[model samples]
Every structure is written in structure tokens, then in C-alpha cells.
Target chain A: MAEDVWILGIRMTKFGKHPDRDLVELAAEASMGALADGGVTMKQMQILAWGSIMSGGMGQQLQKQIGQTGIPVYNVANACATGATALRTVIMAIKAGEADFGLAVGVEKVAGAGLLAGGSRGVDGTTWTPRGPVGAVAPLDGRIGTETMPGVFAQIGLEYGHRYGGTSFELFAKISEKNHAHSTLNPLAAYRKRFTLDQIMNDVMIAYPNTRPMCSANADGAAAAVLVSDTRLRTLSLEQQHRAVKVSASVLTSDPWEEACQVLPDVNTLTRNAATQAYEAAGIGPADLDLVELHDCFATAELVHYDNLKLCESGGAVDFFNSGATWRDGRIPVNVSGGLQSKGHPISATGIANVWEICHHLRGEAGDRQIEGARVGLAHVIGLGSACGVHILEKAAA
Target chain B: MAAARIPLVDYLRLADEPYLVASECEECAARYFNHRVACANCGATAFKEAQVPADGVVRAFTIVSFAAPGIEVPFVSAVVDCHGTSVRANLVNVAPDPEHVRTGMAVRLTTFPIGTDSTGTEAIGFGFEPAAD
Candidate 1:
């Protein structure tokens, strides 16, 4: 018999600073919340998959708080893909019959703890040129100019402008303006303060067209999920099954490592490939998406992704934003929960946050940030180097 | 006269007009800005050295405001399309303002000193400046 997987419970801490708190506290808080929501206890957790950038051995550390369980635990980390990758492991293990119940939890404290606590590798580890703009400091292999993350994306924005005429700087500002405004409605967001287009444009420049307001703020938070096999789910009551959202599709992919340069917003090849498979698996297309919670770590990224995800034609983003099609009441609302820009990005927690937000929308539980009658949702996250994780979610069939 | 110095890359020359070192895939005829161990286009390992023109059109550019330690902020970094190969370099001799630096502008490669070592060997690196008429 083919195994079907379902998300039984989802929980996320308010994404903000908790400097005095450590990873164990953050992880357990979300983990316990998920268990409570799903009507499960630590005794039922058969497998564990933990996610983070640094502060390793999360599954073990978290076990101490929840009671030491002699179960198989996996520590998974793939940059920004940490959350999705961790959640996917849980699904895979449950599908393979290794376990009937699994937990996926992720936590980080980058915003409050500083950069070293965040995941910045110092010097000598670049796979690209003597220098690439992915680092904020000069790496061991390259000069200082090629280090900041903003620099890499800035280069991409520039190329987009050159290739198909231009990627309007105003367009990227509007993305920031919209996302910040959306965040005002989400109390869980780290930054709920809104900014106008003029304010966003006038903010300090991080890299070229990307202003300080255009980048995602580092944050501290945790998000978790509880997954169970359909066999186990069938044993639950009708009310439990009503809240279970189906994990329709999940895909993880990496770069081809070919000898060539990458364009920032033009980084569509890998994502485009992921989209084709995920949509096919979900039995849906871009037009079918009721809501999306994706990696908008940067405002510019949101613009490029709308095209990469094939939601619109290439070079159509300039008009896409102006049409308000992505607004909360628009046809396909994006980041209605404020996204990374307003919600705060804790790296490891981001993917799980997206999953959490989408699940809430699917269940009609999202309060102020709800997308009206959303039926299907997509959660996407990308890690530089890079790894891409995309998942599609829908209501489970009765 | 200043002492002669070598470029950061073996193929990059700093003695005269600045230039770039490139490689071409024998199988696919695709070119690259720096040397390649294998052809990313066709997966062929055999590659021969290729020369790139000093001047090319700017495909994209950014003025880096917050940068690594010791780097001057508000410096213009550019991705230049040198013939068919793409080169990542900083833009020099031009104002770092959007009004001045823009995509599709003409640029030419130039070499600059990157400080000397204990052995008195200066490190030479390459950048692009607005092209001459």
C-alpha cells in the first residue's frame, strides 16, 4: 500500500529577539507547542529531525528538555533550506515506514546574538572566484569587495536591468513598501512598522538599489511541525483529520556546479526546474496557488521569484506589482503574514515559518493576516551555494 | 621607475594595458572569464587559454555602501560583458552615483596596486573604468 503523509500540527514562536534564551529553550517551546496542538506527547515522537545553521546537535539538546528518548534523531542543516530540509526528512522517514510519527523543529538567534552566532564563515571557503559578493567580509580566497550578500544580489539586480531593458529600482522599493505594510497586520512579525516608498528609497543603501529596509532583518525565533503517517492519522477522530493539511509535493535540489557565473534575480534555472516537478506532483500550476510564503530575504528577491516561479511572464514584474495582484485581497496573495522582510528571518526558522503560515491559511486559522478562503499554498526557500526546497500543500482528502 | 609586479592571476597582465584571462570549451565553443578545469557547458576537461578585450559594455553595476573592512564604501562594482565572457570587477574613475554609473555604459579594464608584502612584491588587481571615446 502506498503511504500518504500529513501535517498534524504546526506551531511557531513570535519571531523576535530572545537574547537571554538559548536554542534548547527556543526549540522546546515550539516542539512542545506542536505536540500540544496535535494531541500528541513526547512518547509518540518516534523520529526527530532538527534544523539550524550553527549550534549543532539540536535534536539531542532538545531531547533533554522533552525527556531523553532513545529514538533515531537526525540533525539537518542546509543554510536557508534548513527548515524545509528538516521537515522533508520527517516526511521521508514516515513514508519509508521507519516511524509512524516524526517531529521537525528549527530555531535560531542570529538577530540578538550577533554575526558569529549567526552563520558567517570567516575566510578561505569560497567555491567561486578569488572573491564573490556573497560575503560581508573579504574571504580567504578573495578580496573584500566580493563578500557581502547584498553585493551578490545587487549584481543580479544590475544584470536584470541590462538584459531585458531594466529592472526598475522603484519596483524593488514597492516590494519593500508592500511587505512592510503587510507586516503591520502580523503581531508575530519582528518588525511591524510600515514604510512608504519614499522612506524605503531614502533609507541607507546596503548595495546599490537594495536599501536597508529592502533586506530581511536577522531575528530570533523557532517553528516546528508534527507529521504522522495516514495509517496513524486514520486512527484519530474526525476533528483531528479536519485540520490535517496534505503535503502534496516536496522537492529539494542543488546547483549543477558548472563553470559559469550566476545572475542574481536571474537565478531561475534551478528554481524553474523545481517548480515544474512540484506543480506536477501537486496536480496544480501557478494559477492555482491561493497563497505563497516564500524566501523574501530581500525585497528584490520577491520580484524575481514571481517570474522564476512562472507566476508571470519574464520581465512582467514591473507591471505585476502595479496591478495589486499580490496584495492581501489580490488573486494570489504573497507573504500575507509579512514574509521575511517584516516577519524577521532566523535562517533555520524561516522555512518552517513559511510552512507554518501556509498551514494556518489552509486551515482558515490565520486571523488578521488570513488570505480569503485560501485552499492551496506553496512554501519555498533557497540557500545560497545553493540548495532549493519547494513544497505544495492542500486540504487532506476525507 | 616602479618595480614590476605580477597580476593576481597568471594570465592577467599588469605591465601594460589591463586585460582579462579567459578559457574556451573545445567541444562547445563557449567561453569563460577565468580559467576553467572543465567546460561547464559540455563537461569537457580540455581547455585552451583565450584572450579577452580590455573594453566591454557594462551589463550591470552596484554602488556598495556597506562593505568588508578596509574597503571604501559607496564603490561601484560591475559585471562587464567582455566580448562574450563575463567579468566581475569594480568600476573606477567614475562617480559612484546612479546618474553616472549605469548598465550599458562603455568600460575598459585597468590595473591597480593592492599593497606590498614583506618581500616587496606588490599585488596587482584589475578593475574597469569608463571607456575613452
Candidate 2:
């Protein structure tokens, strides 16, 4: 027999530009809120898992400031999947019977620096390069090169457009239109301005195929969740009878070497593998999902994700988009919280934010962004270097 | 006139004649390119280097308009399949146009200068070009 684990509390800061706060301040606020929401004191927490990409050594600093009652803190960084990785670590600790209650928190603060502002090493023992339009800066090591994030995704759009026989503007416009409409109802979204199809089509191209509106804005924020074992919830005098969301499964996988003719399982295979394992663990399929929060770092990535997640067959994502299957009223509403496209991506915080949104929807506290009667939700996060994490959650039976 | 410093060993290989290096897993039959000391598939360290073919088709490509210092913009980059390995390299000697490139189009390798290092020495790298009929 297996013991059940439940998410008792969740909290997140509004995702946007926060020049006033650092990663620690941002994370502590969310953590404090999560503790209050769960009605659990800091002394009850047995473990703390902190996720942040850019803030080095900030997790320990935050834990100390919050006074976790001498609880063990584990810091993790997996690019965009940092948040999900932290939550998955907590789930594992609970399942292993090592911890009765755990706190998973993720925070990111994007200052004036751009995405490629950080200096890093590459595979060739050289500095990593940042790719962008004219006047891009060379990496510190001068050996590695740089490319804009949008530029990389633009390649996908170029391939998609060439294969489908449509202009890049047409393909990207559809994706922009979908996310913009979805964001109109999400007050926390960074860009709430709705976009017309014509406006999207005519927007200046950041990359050849990707326009400014089609790309996600860099943001700063934090999200946190409190997880407790079934027995622990009862012990803490927390309302155990209340509805709870159980973590069905969490899976992480890296990219595999692909042949030249084959589409490298980079994003597609990792997502499919994680999704398959999660579904198998939960005993459900894609058709059973009520809602999903995916890494739509770019519109092209979203288009590819539709087919990659097995929501549609290969090359059939456009058809699904055309039919409005991904809309809020569609069979499976995607990115209902405006997704990365509208919500803004704060890197490390993005993964935890996805979980925060799902938890809110499950608790029926998502006000305007709530999907009607959403009982189950899935969150997918992908990081650079082809790392991915997928998690599935289900609301307790009424 | 400054004399070109020649390497004692061949450090640069042509894109059309790109060097073939492979890693054969002792634990599994999985093979990889650019020499992986450890088998990623089977997690085996016992591996041997094998030769790979230089010919392959384009898997995907993009024309970059922006580039860092010492690098040219409006350049074509591609993921090419050579033998069984898919390697990413810059495509040169052809029009840097996205429309001209297509998936499954034949391509070959060539070597060119990337830039100077901190030591101020010319560094060369492999790039690709459209295959001649």
C-alpha cells in the first residue's frame, strides 16, 4: 500500500517587472503566504527546496531569513524547469517517508540585463555565445557565440512555414492571437493588451518569422507550494477533510542523440516521455486532461508542442489551431493563465508558477481564469540544454 | 608580410570533408559523434572512436541576422545529418537566405575561421555548404 501526499497550500507573487526586490525578498513573501495559507508553522516544515536560475546562493539566504526552524534546505537550478524540479523533489521526499511536510519555492528577478546577459561555458570549453540582431556582444570567453532566443525559435517557424506553405506572419499571427485573447482575462499577465490578427501579422519581426508580440517578455516573480503527507496533515490539525490535489506523477528526462533525418527528440521526445510516464502513473491519457500549462517560450514552440504532447499528430498542430481546439472552450484548454506568452517568463520561477496556477484552478480560486470544473491539470517545463520536467495533479474527490 | 601559423596537426577539417569521429558504446550498440567519452545511452565509459561519413541532409536551418563581435551577421546555420549523427554547423558559400534552404536538402562540410582567441591566434571551425550535383 502507498501513502498519499497532498498539496495543502500554494502562493505566488504577481509576475512582472520588480526592480525594487531581489530574488530573496520575492521568494520569502511567497513562502510566507504559502505557510499562512496552509495554516502550518515554519517549525512543522521538515524540508525546504528552493529553485532559482540566476540568483546564486540566494536560496540558502532566503531560508535563513525565513527561519525554517533548522529544516534542511536543498537548492536546485535546472533553467526553466527549476520550479517543477523543486516541487518534484518535495514529492519524492514525501513518498520516501523522509519528510512529513515540505516547502517548494521558486523565485527569479530579471533586472536590466537581457536573457543572454549571463556569462557561461559551452560544450567546447569556450564561452557560450548570445545570438541577436546587429551589435550583439561577444561572450566573455570569446570562444562561444550567442544567438537570440527568438532567433532560435524563428528557425522552427521557418521550417513550419516552409513545410505548411504559408508565410511566417500568418503562422505566428495565429499563435499571438490565441495567447493575447487568453491574457485579456488574466490580470496577472505581464502583457494584458489584446492583439488583433492584423496587428500581430504586421508587428515588427524580432526574428524573420517571430514578431515582438509573439515572444514572451522577461519577468521577475516568485511562486511557492506547501506539500504534506496524509498523516502529517491530520497531525498538524490542518483540515485534512478539505479537498486536496494529489501529485500523480513527476518525470524528468534529457535530450537523446538523434539521427540527421529524424527530428531530434530534443523537446518533443522529452515531453512525450515525461507525459507518457506521468499518464501511466496516473492511469490517464491526453484525452483525460482538463487543462494544461506548457512552455510556450515561443509561438512556434507551442505549435510544435501541440503535436509533441500528442494532442495532435505530427504536422497537425495547425489544423488543431485552426479548429480552435486549444481555446478556453476547447476540449482541453491550454495556457489558460495566459501561458508564458502572456504571463511572462522569469526563468526559474516559471515552472513553479505553472503549478501555482493549476493549484489555484483546482481550488476554484482562479476567479476569471478558471476553467469550468477543472478536476485534473498538467504542467510541462523545459529548460535550456534540452532538459524537461512534467507533472500531473488531480483534485480530491468531492 | 606575416606568415600564416600552421598547426603541427590537422585542427581544421573542411565541411564537405568534415572529419568523421564516433563513439561506440561497449555496454550498448549506441553510437555518437564528436567523440563522447561516455556512452550517454548506456552510461558506459568503455568506448572506441569510429569513423563517420561526411555526407548528410539538412535537418533544419536558420539565417541569423544578428551576431557577436568577430562574427558575421545574416549567416546561415543548419543542423545537418552526417552518417548517423546530427551536428549543428554554420552553412557558408551559399546565399544566406531562409527560402533557399529546405529540410532534407543535401549538404557537405567545409572549414573556416571562427575568430581569434585570447592568444590572438586564428581559430578555425567546420561549416556546411550545398552539395554539388
Best by lDDT: 1
Q: On residues A176-282, what C-alpha lDDT tens digit does candidate 2 reach at each position?
A: 78888898888778778888888886775555456677777788889998898877766754354364677777788777654431222256667777777888888
Colliding residue pairs in candidate 1: A123-A140, A124-A140, A130-A142, A132-A146, A135-A147, A135-A148, A136-A147
Candidate 2 docking category? acceptable
Each prediction's whole-model lDDT (CA): 0.78, 0.71
lDDT of 2 by residue, B1-92 (tens): 54232211132333444464555677775665434556667678887665555678776666555434444466666667676566656677
C-alpha TM-score for every candidate: 0.91, 0.85
- CA error at residue A367 for candidate 2, angstroms: 1.7
True contacts kept of each: 0.33, 0.14
lDDT of 1 by residue, A1-398 (tens): 44888899989999988878898899999999998888888899899999999777668889989967898899999988899999999998988899899999988888843222111335333222234322121222123235466667667666665766547778788888888998998888999999999999999888878898888888999999999899999999887899998998888877654423532223556677778889998899999999988778778778767776777778776577678988788877888888887899989989888999999988989887788778899998888768888999997654
State the DockQ of every prediction: 0.40, 0.23
